[model samples]
Target: MTARHVLLLGPLLMLLGAAYLLPFLGVMRWSVTLPEPGFGQYHAALSDPLVLGVIWRTVRICAVVTVIAVAAAYALTLIWVRGGRTARTLVELCIMIPFWISVLTRAFGWLALLSNKGIINGWLQSLGFLSEPLTLVRNEFGVVVGMVHFLIPFAAFPLATAMRSVDERVLLAARGMGASRTRIFWQIFLPMTKNGVLGAALLVFVFALGFFVTPAILGGGRSVMVAELIYLRIFQSPDWGLGAAISVILMVTVGLLLGVMMRQNRGAAR
Candidate 1:
């Protein structure tokens, strides 16, 4: 890069850093010093079982969502890359269309599909598959479903971008060299796209960690996540201190995960 490029990029980097850092600094101050002083809020955040449980639930749900989204995205990307023009266009449209719709609307749609008297249960009952509703909505299962729906597109977009860059001739050559389909994918395609998959997984997991509306609407009060917990602390309890503490913890958790991901990527590159 030229000196002129560095000069132009310096201010942009500083601006971006300030944008991200200022709010976090404020949160850190508030978390430690609000509602009196010292690290009381942090202590509360760490010690409270309810708070810990919510954090754990958020991590667990996000992990599941990330796994499902990444796996499904990789499979879909393979199809999209190998497919004919018409098929590729159709699948790409299907994957991208969800992003245009509101998350709330999508959550509502899932509600309709998973509710006790909704389409799924109604269909199951009609077919004598079950005598009653299968307890799909208003639970962990509902939360995961809604999260997966929202995250799948995010995972797919990146994986598709990566897959598009893969060399078709190389894959064909591997097959010509008497490599099995599974062997070719595991040894060649998977290694080539590993970075993108990891990047997408981290992206999806972080976004899922901070998710609010879907869990609120679908999980109801039963399965609370950290974001919902933060909301309650800020508005319902009028405890800005605790809210800030939770926010700081959440941000730090994401930062640590992101740092780990970066290190792994660097190691992989090396």
Candidate 2:
């Protein structure tokens, strides 16, 4: 509140600006100024078929990953909320263990399981279940599996916070009135956690949009997404202007999603 307090915070504020804000502004500048300037890069990006395809694939994959992650997290949160202490501990460990693992490690683990010559296919072949291996890795299916595995924790913790806030007595009362178990879950229990579910879904979807490692590794360059595309443009192909423009588009998309999430959270508080 005092000038002394403001002075105390000044160094930290400057450090943050120098570290994050300046770099962000530089990226924004490169999008317009690089490759002979103007907004020509944006125009080319919008009209280019390859760019359009990559953007569409990224959005579609992220949507699928978000839906699956949120649903799976909701189930896991239910167990954590209602199960015994031992079960809660088990759930916590399951979620947190994967959360702490490196994304690259997890991607390789999935690759080992899903690849044609990998564990799953080999096991199936040995048992005579199939003459050939299923096409699992290096495609959209493999990318989805890896993304969902990585995102489940991001979706679960927020949902647990929401679910824990619900009044157990309300569910008990509904049960006392002879409400069917299905009815109670579908109508009462789920509605109580709706905001949390929405919040988790938005969080997962936004994170999925920027995902780079798992998609790149599992996809084997076959299932390219926006982040991977950005990398190829900047590093592999040396097209800084196009890469920066794509980065700007991704940043704007995330910003709009966060703005919507904030407005929804405020409305829910009311």
Candidate 3:
């Protein structure tokens, strides 16, 4: 708030700009100026059906993954909150194991499990569920499976922390009034966990938007999302302008989403 303190922040601000903001500005510059300096590239990409489809597909996939992650996180947090110590330990271990594994490693693991000759298909065929292997890998189903797996832990940890802070006295009072387990959870426990759930959903959904590996390996190019499309434009086709333009769009969209969530959160607090 004072001049001396403001001057003290100059070096750090410059460092941050150099490290992050500068590169982002460069991308924005490229998006606008590349391919002969006009808004033409943005219009071209926007009008292209394939590009529009990829953007929509990316949004759809992330939405589905967010919903699944939040639901799974809610159930998992309930177990961790109410179960014994051993159960809590097991849940913590599950979350930590995924944390340790790299994204590509897990994506490859899904490739093994979902492939035509993969374990799931082999087991199902052996059990006479199908005479032939059902198509699982290299499709949207496989991509969704992998994305949901990646997001569940992200969405659960925060909810678990929130659940731990919930007062048990409220639940006991509800029980004394003879509320059923389902009714109590729906009316009391879950409402208390709403903030955590919203935060987790926002985090997971944003992260899911930028996902690259799981969709790539599992989708096999058939179910291309916006991130993969950006990769294709830059690496595969050498369309730097288009790629930069798309990147700008993605970043702007993410920024708008984050701003909306923050505004809603502040309004709720008020």
lDDT of each: 0.90, 0.94, 0.88
TM-score against truth, every candidate: 0.89, 0.96, 0.92
Q: Pick the candidate with the highest TM-score.
A: 2
Q: Write one digit per residue (lDDT tens) for candidate 1, span 1-270.
A: 999999999999899879988878988898988988899999999999989888888889999999998998888777788778988888888798998999999999999999999999999999999997899988999999999988888888768767877889999999999999999989999998888898889989989999999999999878899999999999999899999999998998889988987886686557
Deviating ranges (above 4 Å) for candidate 3: 1-15, 264-270
Cα distance off (Å), candidate 2, residue 171: 1.0
The candidate 1 region of ten consecutive residues with least summed lDDT is 261-270
The better-scoring model by lDDT among 1 and 2 is 2
lDDT of 3 by residue, 151-252 (tens): 888888778777877889999999999999999989998898787788788888889899998999999999999899999998999888899899989998
Scored by lDDT, model 3 comes in at: 0.88
Better of 2 and 3 by TM-score: 2
Better model by TM-score: candidate 1 vs candidate 3? 3
Ranking by lDDT: 2, 1, 3
lDDT of 2 at 233: 97
